[model samples]
Target chain A: EDQVTQSPEALRLQEGESSSLNCSYTVSGLRGLFWYRQDPGKGPEFLFTLYSAGEEKEKERLKATLTKKESFLHITAPKPEDSATYLCAAAGASNDYKLSFGAGTTVTVRA
Target chain B: GAGVSQSPSNKVTEKGKDVELRCDPISGHTALYWYRQSLGQGLEFLIYFQGNSAPDKSGLPSDRFSAERTGGSVSTLTIQRTQQEDSAVYLCAGRGGQGRSGANVLTFGAGSRLTVL
Candidate 1:
């Protein structure tokens, strides 16, 4: 069974603090790993798609790195605006195009 | 709209009543998807439609849940005998072909919040 798990269900970070959220998965044939940020009352916004191990992507103060077993979303000097729920999902190579997602990690960057 | 659009941003209903949610995918997008998100939870795949292909309804939780896509453009999700457990945000997404290798990203709508009392 394919499953995605995100750890540290909730995190409270002081403004400008650096932290990393974890996403571990078990899939039949890895196709893609996705990261999304969701704010209250809205759908998730795309962040990054990591296709292979040892790959990394960055945007402003956010960086995402992937490995064979898991992926990490690293927030550098996160501001209060960065506070949101981060989601992780995995898509297998079955052509279904369905993504299995984790429960998400809620981060609160207090100012 | 340039982005995916969903109707009735908020719906409050009594248990056992049926509810329908609509989604209008971005124009020219061949792939459409529906998902459910509970409070503080990740997305739960509900159904998918790609071009003229048959929709994959494997993720639907029960037989009372059904969806239809008309002309491969707009889609509707219907839930019968809604229960409190069905309260959640329903999200719709559209995916366009980015390249020949099937590299595409899903653009999501703001979502419709369903509250079953």
Candidate 2:
């Protein structure tokens, strides 16, 4: 079974603080790795999709990097609005799009 | 219309009652997905529908959980004889693309919060 594990279950940071969340995985064959941001009471919003090692993608204050065994989401100078649970998922070798997700890291940015 | 939408934002039901949740994907989207989120658990994939083909229901936990997509646009998930463990937020998403690598980003709905007592 493909498995995803995220570190630092909860993170608290002051406004403008920078930190990184980690997502490690083990799968038979990796088709894609995905990053999503979810707010309380809402569904997850897609952030980035990394297909190979050394691949990186960026948004306003977030950067996602993927390697053979893991993916990382780095938040730079985060604001209160940036606070949300970060989710990481891995799609296996099969054509099916079933994604195995990690428990997620809850981030709270204080103003 | 613009994004994936789910109906009945909140549902409170008796433990033995059945509940049906609905999802309306963005117009023209070819793929639809269902997931459940418990208090501390991560998002759990429940089922997936693509075009007019058979759905992938491997993620469903039991026979009590079933879903159907109609007209390739609207989908419904029906849970029979709900249990306390069934209390969670159910989310839906839509995707479009010919392949996994080319699949468009998934757009998610606000989710339906189901509380069984």
Candidate 3:
């Protein structure tokens, strides 16, 4: 079974502080790795998709990178609005569009 | 719509009752997915639809759960004799018709919060 595990279940940071969340996974043949941001009572919003090691994508203050065994989401100079649950999911080559997600890291940025 | 849309944003029901949740994918998206979120947990895949054809449904929890899509468009998930364990947020997502490297990309709705009494 494909599995994903995220570390630092929760994190608190002051405004403009920077931190990185981890997403480790084990899959037969990773087809894609995805990052999503979800707010309380709202569904997840797509962020980035990493398909290979050494690949990276960034949006505003968020940057996502992938390696063979894990992926990292780095937030730089975060603001209170950036506070949300960050989810990591992996889709294996064996399954088409089926995603296995990690428990997620809840990030809270204080202003 | 601009994004995936789900109906009945909130539903409170008694155990043993049946409920139906609906999803309207983005206009041109050919793939749709249903997921369950319990409290603060991660998303649990419930099912997926590829152009109105559900090639996989093993993620569904039990026989009491069934879903269908028509005309290659909207879809619905029906739960029979609901239980308290069924209380959670039901989220629906959709992806573009073509794009394997990015096939896993999903756009989600706000989700429907279900509460079983």
Candidate 4:
């Protein structure tokens, strides 16, 4: 079975603070690792997709990197608008279709 | 529609009652997925339909929960004898294809919040 685990269930940071979220996974024949951001009362929004170790993708204030056994989402100088739940998921080649997700890390950035 | 659309944005039901949730995927998308999200929990895969191929129902929690896709676009999830534990936000998403590029990204709907009492 594919398992995805995230650390630091909740994070509190002042505006402009930078930190990173971790996602550990054990997937058979890993295919892709995904990141998503979700706000209260809203569905998650797609963020990035990492296909292999050492691969990285970035957006406005978020950068996602993947390794052999884990992935990291680095937030650079986060703002209040960046407060949201960060979710990580992994899809394996064996099941090519199913995605296993983590509990998620809820970020609260206060300005 | 511009993106994945789910019906009955909010629902309140009693135990033992059956409820049906609907999903209308994006145009020309061949892959559709249904997931359940409980408070403070990760998304739980429910089912997925890819084109004309057989759907993957392995993620379904139980036999009471069933889903079907019609014409390879819209989908309906039916939960019979709903239980309190079944209360959650039901999310529907669609992927254009299996490619690693844009086609692989899943576009999600606002989700249908189901509350069973």
Candidate 5:
């Protein structure tokens, strides 16, 4: 069975602190890995998609890197406004397009 | 361009009542998806519609959940005999069907929050 697991269920960081969240997966074939940020009362917002090992993408203080069995979302100098639940999902080779998502890591930045 | 849109941002209904949630995908996006998110939980895939072909309903939790896409544009998800456990945020997303960029990034809507009393 394909599964995704994220580490550090919750993290409290002071403003300007940098950290990384981990997402590990077990699947037959990895088609894509996705990262999303979700705020309260809203749907998730797309962040990045990594297709192959060693692939990396970035957007405004957030960087996503992928490997053969896992992915990492690194936040640089995170601010209070950047606090949100970060989710990681993986799609398999079957083209089912059904993303198996991790439970997500909740980050709270204290000012 | 307008992103995916869902109707009735919030809904509250009594148990055993039926409810219908609507999704309007971005114009020209042929791939639409539905998911459910319980409080503080990750997304649970509900269904996927690719063009006019039959949808993939494998992820639906029960037979009481059904969805249909009309004209390859708007889609509706209907839950029959709602239960208290059915309460969740229903999210809709859309992507270009084929020949798009790698992996076809999904655009999501604000979602509809359902509460069963």
Candidate 6:
């Protein structure tokens, strides 16, 4: 089965602090790796897509990097608004390109 | 609409009662998907529709769950004889009709929170 696992189920960061969240996946013929941000009571919002190893995408203070076996989302000088659950997903040909999302990493940034 | 829109933002019901959740995807999006999010579990895929055709529904957990799309725009998910375990946030997403690459470009709604009593 295709699987996406995230580390540090929850993280607490002070204002202006920086950190990174890990998402490891095991999918056959991986097609794309995606990042999403979800706030409480809201659905997920797309962040980036990494189609190949060594690929990276950035938005504001968030940067997403991909490797063959894993992906990383780095938050730089995070603000309270940047605090949300970060989700990672993997889509592969074997899985019909359906996204399999990770449990997610909840970051709490206090200002 | 501006983005995917789901109706009945919150629904509270008793066990065994049936419920229907609705989703109006972004205008012109031909790909639609439904997912379930439990308290501690990851997003669970339920179904996908590509221009009114369900190419895959293997993600649906049980027979009690069924969904349909019309005019390639609005969709509905109906749960028959609901159970306590069915309580979760049902999310709806949609994207362009493009091929494989477009499959990952999904736009989501706020989701409907279902609570079973």
Q: What is candidate 2's CAPRI-style docking category based on DockQ?
A: medium
Task: Put down candidate 1 lDDT per residue, B1-117, tens digits, no spaces.
Answer: 778889889999999999999999889998899999997677888888887464587889999999988887989999999999999999999987753224356889999999999
Off by over 4 Å in 4: B101-103
The reply for model 2, stretches above 4 Å from the true place, is: B99-104
What does candidate 1's lDDT look like per residue over A40-103, in tens digits? 8787889999888999999999999999999999999999999999999888767527788999
Residue B8, candidate 6: Cα error in Å is 0.7
Report the CAPRI category for model 3.
Answer: medium
DockQ of each: 0.64, 0.67, 0.73, 0.57, 0.59, 0.69
Candidate 6 residue lDDT tens string, B1-117: 998999899999999999999999999998899999999789999999988999989988899999999999999999989999999999999977555543467789999999988
Off by over 4 Å in 3: B100-102
Q: What is the TM-score of chain A in candidate 5?
A: 0.96
Candidate 6 runs further than 4 Å off: B99-103
Clashes of 4: 0
- Candidate 2: lDDT over CA atoms? 0.89
Candidate 3's DockQ: 0.73
For model 3 chain B, give the 10-residue run with minimal summed lDDT. B96-105
Per-residue lDDT of candidate 4, residues A1-111 (tens digit):
999999999999999989999999999888789999999878889999898999999999999999999999999999999999999999987776777889999999999
DockQ of 1: 0.64
* Fnat scores for every prediction: 0.67, 0.65, 0.76, 0.59, 0.53, 0.65
- Please provide TM-scores, in order, for all candidate models, with all chains considered together: 0.95, 0.95, 0.97, 0.96, 0.95, 0.96
List, residue by residue over A9-64, the lDDT tens digit for candidate 6: 99999999999999999988888899999999899999998888999999999999
TM for candidate 1 is 0.95
User: Candidate 5 chain A: worst 10 consecutive residues by lDDT?
Assistant: A91-100
- Tell me which of candidates 2 and 6 scores higher on lDDT: 6
TM-score of chain B only, all predictions? 0.93, 0.93, 0.94, 0.93, 0.93, 0.94
